[model samples]
Target: MRLWVCIALLSTVLCASAERPRIVQGMIRAGQFVRDAAGGTRDMYRAYKDMREANYRGADKYFHARGNYDAARRGPGGAWAARVISDARENWQSRVSGRGAEDTRADQEANRWGRSGGDPNRYRPRGLPSKYYTRDDLHLLWLCRSAVAWPGTMRLWVCIALLSTVLCASAERPRIVQGMIRAGQFVRDAAGGTRDMYRAYKDMREANYRGADKYFHARGNYDAARRGPGGAWAARVISDARENWQSRVSGRGAEDTRADQEANRWGRSGGDPNRYRPRGLPSKY
Candidate 1:
């Protein structure tokens, strides 16, 4: 009778141990996923900023061009008789305005979910049910489920307590994957914005170039018509304007060359320019 009772008790203990939930492994896997996701989120943010900087630099060139063009149009002689230069200046102004608007929109979109109100703890994990689980609660639940497995084993108690402490602590932390998803969205929006802004900048640059060409052509004709009375003065003004335009164009061409080189390097490495540092002008520029 005594032997049978001992065997029955041992069997019951074994069955209870078998039924205990194995949460430590699951918690470990989840923690690893969270760490990886957090790291990826950091990378995404860096990439977004780099892309934005590239777009800003590209847009800035056109802005300088527009400024130079406007100054040339409003030169010392006041307004010229050529209506074409005036019209071209107006068109360039419109393009510059449009580019400015697009740039503002892109900046807003990129910072949509950024931290606000100077709250440092805004991103810190809060162990709430809706936000995350509490370690104490998870520990108690796990203990309740496995309490019957080894009621009198001190070693089992010690092991369970340690495991519960570690696993529950890990599980109760904020899910980094959530923040990673938000970062991923930011990256997507930034990439799209960068592409749009780059295209707009290129279009504006080309349009400004065409307008400059027209302005120069019209100025040449005007200078030719006024060649009798003050031809020397007109020739000097036109020459100055030509030199200014050429200088601006040459500077812009150099910038474009650098950008193309960066693009080529990125392509050779099979990396996205938006995601990595390209060998070009500093972003602060």
Candidate 2:
């Protein structure tokens, strides 16, 4: 009996020793997961801030891709966090803010591309500053390509490329301006504006669209506004005229008219038409 008891005690000790290592390993894994998730969240926030500060109109997709890419690089936990955040953001935009389905899908595509380690540079806008890119070597490549063809002087071109990159990196990032529409462009814009408004009306009538009037209104204005100052002016005139007719003749309530006007102004002022667009709309539009 004494020998049996000693053997039993030794077995128990061995089991405890083996279990302890597994528990320690589990704790370490859990800790790493938490750290990775935190890092991913940070990456998302940083990307958003950078996008806002850069405010380069067409570079939004690039930033979206970059953020997801960075987070996914952290590992499983990071990928999970990024996906969760991105889905949540899109959900809020679609359900609450009335953003378009097409836009959301496009954003998701960019997100997936980044997570899968695909280059975000595909969506990069022309003239977007080199500073906004993660790969600084691209700037050198661009400079080298543009360098006044130094015929046979390969070394000179290489030195110029290197020097240009250094100077560009040190220079403060220039603010990108969507330059003003020139006076000469007004005539062409005016014609385009009228066409856009008419097309919107025609589409609405033909589609017999009922649920998303505000989206149509915003889209028409957005298309018109893209034509420049003349388009903006034409949009305002048409919108005001339509609202007056609806309130006075068509018997639309003041509240409805007001909402319509708000949507019109939103698009006219260069706000995204997707902000008023609903899901399930045909993407061909």
Candidate 3:
């Protein structure tokens, strides 16, 4: 499925290239040739031969189709065709033979792998795929060739290059914005968790205070009611109550300390505190 999608994308790009200026299209084709040569995927020399033959036929047709002397005189033929073909061949050779920066880097990486007794062919670039080449690179090569093929297209090439650069930058802006959004969400989630934990600690403290107040009031009544034969029993009850109150206070204090420590740990780690929230706990609380 992924392979099919890639093929579809490449096809779409090629179709789009057709709509580009003639010089750009030529550059794209030339770039393709260079890429094929580097990857050893196709017989580029044969492909070039075919391209030359096709161009020759096209030129011949254009010259003979119209019998007008003035049109034939104005048409690019003979010397012009020879120069364009020769320059394109040279460009193709230079690009395919590791003359460009990318090609040079690829060669260096391959050499490193070879020296390490590894399969150099298996080494791929960091960002790009092993066989991947950009349309922009191809377009530049086409532009170079176009300068030789038809010098008049140089100004148009500059315009297209500028426009494409802007478009490429705009295309990349969304990814940068997406990264910012993800970072914002992470910060917001961390803050929310901290707030929730603080609220939980507040509720626990309030509940502990209320229980402590009730126990103290009950102990006071017991102390006042102590009398006669039941004095020992009342004393025992008072002692147990005091012990129970102390235990509760100690337990609550420990729990509060633990909760605070946990919250602090989460805050430092940039973790979501709400992940430890008790079930059935109200969000407002």
The worst-scoring run of ten residues by lDDT in candidate 2 lies at 175-184
> For each candidate, what is the lDDT?
0.35, 0.70, 0.36
Model 1 per-residue lDDT tens digits across residues 1-285: 989856744543333221223453344344444454444343333333433454543333222222222222222221121123334534575577665655544433222212111111222233312212222223344544544564578646644544443343321234553343233333333433334333433443554543233222322323232222233233334444544675577675655444433433332232322232222323221
Output candidate 2 Cα RMSD.
Answer: 23.7
Residue range 37-86, candidate 3, lDDT tens digits: 33321222322333344453222211111111111122233223323333
lDDT of 3 at 252: 57
Using all chains and alpha carbons, the TM-scores for the candidates as numbered come to: 0.17, 0.42, 0.18
**On TM-score, who's better, 1 or 3?**
3
Tens digits of per-residue lDDT, candidate 2, 1-285, equal 989856644553333221234544455456567778999898888878889999988788888887887888677778888899989988888887766898899899999988886656677777777666542233345544544465668757555645444334312222221011122235346667888988887876776656567777887898999777889888889989999999998787999999999999998987656666556556545
Task: For model 2, name the residue pairs that clash.
Answer: none
Root-mean-square deviation of Cα positions for candidate 1 versus the true structure, in angstroms: 35.2
Comparing 1 and 2 by TM-score, which wins?
A: 2
Taking every candidate in turn, the Cα RMSD to the unseen true structure, in Å, is 35.2, 23.7, 30.9
Displacement of the residue 271 alpha carbon in candidate 1, Å = 27
